[model samples]
Target: MRYAFALAAVLCASPALAQQPTAPAPGSNHDARPQFDISTGVDFERGDFGTGAQVDKIAIPLTAGVSIGSVRVSAQLPWVRVTAPANVIAPTGPLGLPILVDPTRPATRTTRQGLGDLRLGAAYDLPVQGIVASVRAAAKLPTASVDKGLGTGKADYSVGADVAKPLGAVTPYAGVTYTMAGDPEGFQLRNSFSGQAGAALRLGGSASAQLGYAYAQNPIEAGEDDQRIVGGLHADVGRSLSLGVYGSGGLSAGAPRLGGGVTLGLKFGR
Candidate 1:
């Protein structure tokens, strides 16, 4: 009976050991894997102007990466169709003074439909053993039309760092990001700083939940900040497949919005 009990304990621990994230020294591990995550969902959001709009975005995000020993390299591509209102700010601006000053312009509706921005970025994860810490840089390439109510078609830059620490039953992580505008004249610049702090809960085997808060500086457009509560879930649907969902809820009165997204992914390699 003693031998049988020991065998059973080992069997139950095997799965947990296999699912744990790689644990390197306090500052040694840096790269993740080449994983593809795709999510298509609707965002019921309100703009800085306190207007409500529902836009459906098909986000195909791909993260191809590899960590050698403790060094890491990875890239991610994000395509989104962020929808506001019909006559909303005329997509990209430089509007006539009349339109810019008129309070009724945003209230008008227009017949326009199309894609938004295309983002491509690369990151080098810094070496942090035991605990994980890395700096990431990204760029947003304008692919949508800035004219016909599509997008700004202007490039943007972002820089940030993230840190993760494991404690007992949970892992706590936090990070901050800053965005710079390219063409402040032709398009709206998002001059904001966002920070998120969350903890991960491991559930027996292949599932986990992360809940945290994200706060952003007041957006360029008054009354629009990304301050919200965020919750995310990850589950291994199969041996090679995983699913995730995330939701954000606004915290303030100005254009505070609520939305959620779902992700489906297939991973390969070790």
Candidate 2:
């Protein structure tokens, strides 16, 4: 459950799916060159995750990235807070497997806060006819404290590919990922697969909206699979500033009942 929550936070903090780069606003001094980007945002989610007791989570993530030619690289680190039953241990990093201290033990309210795992990722844009496509890989470094239930104490990795094609004012895209879960001391986590499909609609020259659905296989054998509907609104404010607001609603007990967040991004260099 904690793993599910952490992953949800990471997903929510990200920009909308299928969003294509748009031209700078008219009269703006935006440079048409490869650039470095930085973004930060806060995300919140609440859910029972099939457990009888409710859990709440908050994450504030900082991310930075740069594009060079057809390749892009990025890093992200987040601060996370969790409040839940004592039996429900909270793991601070994304893609962690949920671990219950004692499923049979009576639960008590508990809270944990700390820095989360560090994530590093790289991607290569694939040249394709009439479509944007990319292949990506990411790794989660175990940085949080396992003793404090802030991480799995082991690393995780994932690889995926996505493609988007523009059709008039709408861009439709789909992606699939395979994650290798880390097995902790007493737990055997299962590798999982996740996928998303979405379309982004250009609202004008500077704004767009996206709607999507996502599904993930459960990393825990006894846990329910995760499913959700997601959407977002994004806008460019100036030559180098952008804003995004997004929301999600769970379609399964494995996901947050509802979640939302805002992100602000800045771009530098030409």
Candidate 3:
């Protein structure tokens, strides 16, 4: 029953019903593969908190990509809104109860209702035989609120490598990313390093699943590290459409794991 529920959850996670560019970007193929490939999806994530922690947030991401020669570019814009039910701290005093207040007042906290982060970057393939290797560099623009629930308001940068190889029916991949956080205005967070590894499995021609792990450094002195194991399912539903569902769980209490979400993806052109 647990396996069945997990399978069902994977199937409904994201839209993998569309076709993607088989070959690398233009100059990447030394043969000019495809001009562009675009996909857009939304993820509804539920995160589990610690003993007395509360965290519930919804994020919608709109993404698109272009391949101009060996240079491939993709952009992701996310809109997030969160509500932490038990995040409220109240005063416990004499006459029955003290002052109790909802830290995240949705009605009054709608001010943080805009785009979260803007990511822009490009990937350049490194010529290799029987394998896929590339270097990627990107910048995360401060578009979301670090304060009032909107954005971090601090710009960040990331550089990493993408490597992939096929094994029987699965194509495994690994990557490492480092980000530098800018100064804070309201609640500017600290900078950290993140590492991720995953793979895409070909289940016939219209379906695939990506499973991986991610680890991030903790900026808070009293907190543990952030570790995540993520999985994503993609399937082609139509000629130019796809669906996906993604989920992640915390391997240990060192970080806030237990996260799951759903996505819908669309693609057009060859």
Model 3 worst lDDT window (10 residues) = 90-99
For each candidate in turn, the TM-score is: 0.68, 0.86, 0.71
Better of 1 and 3 by TM-score: 3
Predictions in order: lDDT: 0.42, 0.65, 0.46
Q: Once superposed on the true structure, which residue ranges of model 2 sit more than 4 Å away at CA?
A: 1-9, 12-34, 92-106
Residue-level error in angstroms, candidate 2, position 236: 0.9
lDDT (10s digit) by residue, model 3, range 129-198 = 7666777676767666544444435565656565677676776666555556554433334555555565
User: Which regions of candidate 1 deviate over 4 angstroms?
Assistant: 1-84, 89-106, 110-112, 184-190, 219-223, 254-256
Worst 10 residues of 1 by lDDT: 1-10
- Top candidate (TM-score): 2
Residue 72's lDDT in candidate 2: 77
How does model 3 score by TM-score?
0.71
Better of 1 and 3 by lDDT: 3
* lDDT of each residue in 154-183, candidate 2, tens digit only: 888888777777787877767777778787
**True-structure lDDT of candidate 3:** 0.46
**What's the candidate order when arranged by decreasing TM-score?**
2, 3, 1
Candidate 1 lDDT by residue in tens digits, 15-50? 000011211112343235333333222222233323
